[model samples]
Target: MPITLPNGITAIELADDYPALQIETADCSATLALNGAHLTHWQPSHTAHPVIYLSPTAILQQGKAIRGGVPLCWPWFNAHPTDPDSHPSHGVARIERWDLISATVEDGSAIIELELKASPVIEAHVPFPFQLKALFNLGQTCSIVLETTNLAKENIAVGGALHSYFSLSHIDNATVTGLQHTPYLDTAARPEKSAVQTEGELRFQAETDRIYYGSDLPARIHDAEWKRSIVVEKAGSLTSVVWNPWIEKAASLGDLPDADYQRFLCIEAANARHDTRILAPGSTHRLETRFIVENLS
Candidate 1:
């Protein structure tokens, strides 16, 4: 039987790639892959530029993480904490298939929910057993709700991030506002560097990677080239990750183009570092991020 989607929403299969959903509405248009429930494209009709950044050289094949857009990093983040030598980067969520639970259009916005159940592959990555559910609301703004539930009998710790790659008119034209006065760990440094507080809005010059601690405040990306700003708001998250691969790192990534570093900025909403949560059996934790694009002109 075919799944019936609400008005302006259609189920789509990506040729030889993953099965996904195509959302079209009066205010915006977007594409979401069921593989990881990854949101690859989202562009509002009023804006000339895309809201999400996708790599031109990204390989859309199976079992590989897509190079851009919003990739979910769950269970664990970055490299494996203890098994970094052998485990995968960012866990197995991005490479797994998710089932569509429901789809409905509410008050002009399209809300789609999807679920990822535990499996042998997920079990192989983490010691604890758990499940995940994600909800996407596409409208004047984009909101993602991620809920994680613990299934084991004992308490377990977890951390991860939304890991959003936002499109930019040009890398130099973007500066992130907020996260100032908050402590952060610079991950790009050799031994890693720690700062007591971020001074002001962040600007790009070189490769940047920092994990901010204890900040739940909203952040905004001021895009001078496009004459617009993107507001990032989060709930149930304490850590913020701001990163830019710059020239050298971008060149080394097979999925990202050499000079393409000039095109995007990643300011993630996360639960990482000291903010990792401990969940008891039968308990569920929710993390959400809301993105709004404002035209400056």
Candidate 2:
């Protein structure tokens, strides 16, 4: 069923089971998929370029991740905390179809909520069961709040992130701020992982993958070529992962263009690695993040 909204836009079916919800608000325009409650696009109407970067070769399938956009990583982050060989890369949340809970336009902003309940398939991968909900606000300050509550009788440790892929004019033309002196482990570094302190505005030169901990400051990507800056702020998150696969690694990704490495940067608001959250039974943990775009002056 194609549901029409108050703004006269319809959420059309993009797949047999997934409906791609196109949103047009006064502040911006965006698209979301019910599958994983994944946000695929978001651009402020005033901006010249798309704020959220989506890969050109991104595959839109039922079970596969869309490669780009804002993929929700939950229950676990990266390889399984316990089972690295067999579990999903991020978690079970992004691969499962979430049920629509509500959708409404509030003060010219699109507010949508989607829920996911645990079942046999999820149980097979994760021992603990959970009830999850994702709230999206596509407007001036694009926001996403992920709520996960443990359903089992015992406490459960969970990790998640709003893995945001941001658009940039070019890799060399951008620099990251607000994470100065922050401690991070460079997972892609050679001779085992290297723990280093960030100095000044971080610039990318190669395949970069770092897990930053103990930081609550807003990370800003200053894009000189695009003439804009992206500010990422978060709450209830203690970890941030910054990455950009330069040339060789980008060519190896089947769902991403080879040159896309110069076009995007990922500054994620995450509770990952050592920043895992523990939720008691019937208690919920909310991971919230907001994206604010500012023109460079």
Candidate 3:
């Protein structure tokens, strides 16, 4: 059954038979859904068409909807670099079903807690015994807090990220500020050298993927066409992943249509190859990030 949380946030209940969870916020009338705990939709209003398209067809059956907002791709983090046992690319938690343990509203924000336990399906991919909780608060500002507690007796190396696919009116009309004079990994460069170059504002041109490390600067995404700016504030997680699949790679991911690539950008907080945290037995680690939206016109 779907229950109405405090501050007028409604949460759709999850049944063991299905893999769907819905969170609706009153402030912006934003609705977010999780299909098998993978991001299904995150848009402001129902009448407003998704800025990003999840499927090529309409009427997505069996919990498959048009995912047009931020998708939280967590767990094993990214590709393990030819390592078979280092967890799959982007982890197993994306498809794993997370449980909703508690829901509360505080300070005009709706906080919903979700947990993932050691299940048969999850154990097949990630054999670690652990308890993970993701607290999602949606309101004046959207925030997600991920807390993981190890249940096993031994230590475990953990790597993960909250993949947020932010939609834009147009790729060419947007720019990412606050990254001036920062060192970044030039993915296009062979052998991937780290160099410090002063690039004023991020632009979409060619296949770009870089991990900006040791930076706590607030990443702000501005869409000139839409006249909107999304300011990202972070804590616990230091690195940010900025990428746009562009034209070529977009055609490769057959699941995504060609035009969809021009409508969205992936800005994620990730713990990838460079920096990884190893949590000890009975130890817990927390990562937090906030997204504040504003009209810049």
- Candidate with the greatest TM-score versus the true structure: 1
**CA error at residue 277 for candidate 3, angstroms:** 0.8
User: For model 3, what is the alpha-carbon lDDT of residue 243?
Assistant: 78
Model 3 spans with C-alpha error above 4 angstroms: 1-21, 34-68, 81-87, 106-108, 188-190
- TM-score winner between 2 and 3, please give it: 2
Worst 10 residues of 1 by lDDT: 57-66
lDDT of 3 by residue, 188-273 (tens): 55788887647788788777788777766589988887777878777767677777777887787756787777887877776766
Q: Write the per-residue lDDT of candidate 2 for residues 1-297, one digit (tens) a residue.
A: 523466723577766767878888778888988877888889887788999888989877877887889999988888898888877888878888887777888876888888887767677778887788999988877999999888889999999789999999999999999988888888888754746564788988889998888988599999998899999999989999998988999989999988999999998889998899988999999999999999876
Q: What's the lDDT for candidate 1?
A: 0.87
* True-vs-predicted CA distance for residue 181, candidate 3, Å: 2.4
lDDT scores of the candidates, listed in order: 0.87, 0.86, 0.65
Clashing pairs in 2: none
At residue 93, candidate 2 shows an lDDT of: 83
Listed in order, each prediction's TM-score against the native is 0.96, 0.95, 0.83
Model 1 spans with C-alpha error above 4 angstroms: none
* Positional deviation of residue 177's Cα in model 3 after best superposition, in angstroms: 0.9
Error of 2 at 106 (Å): 1.6
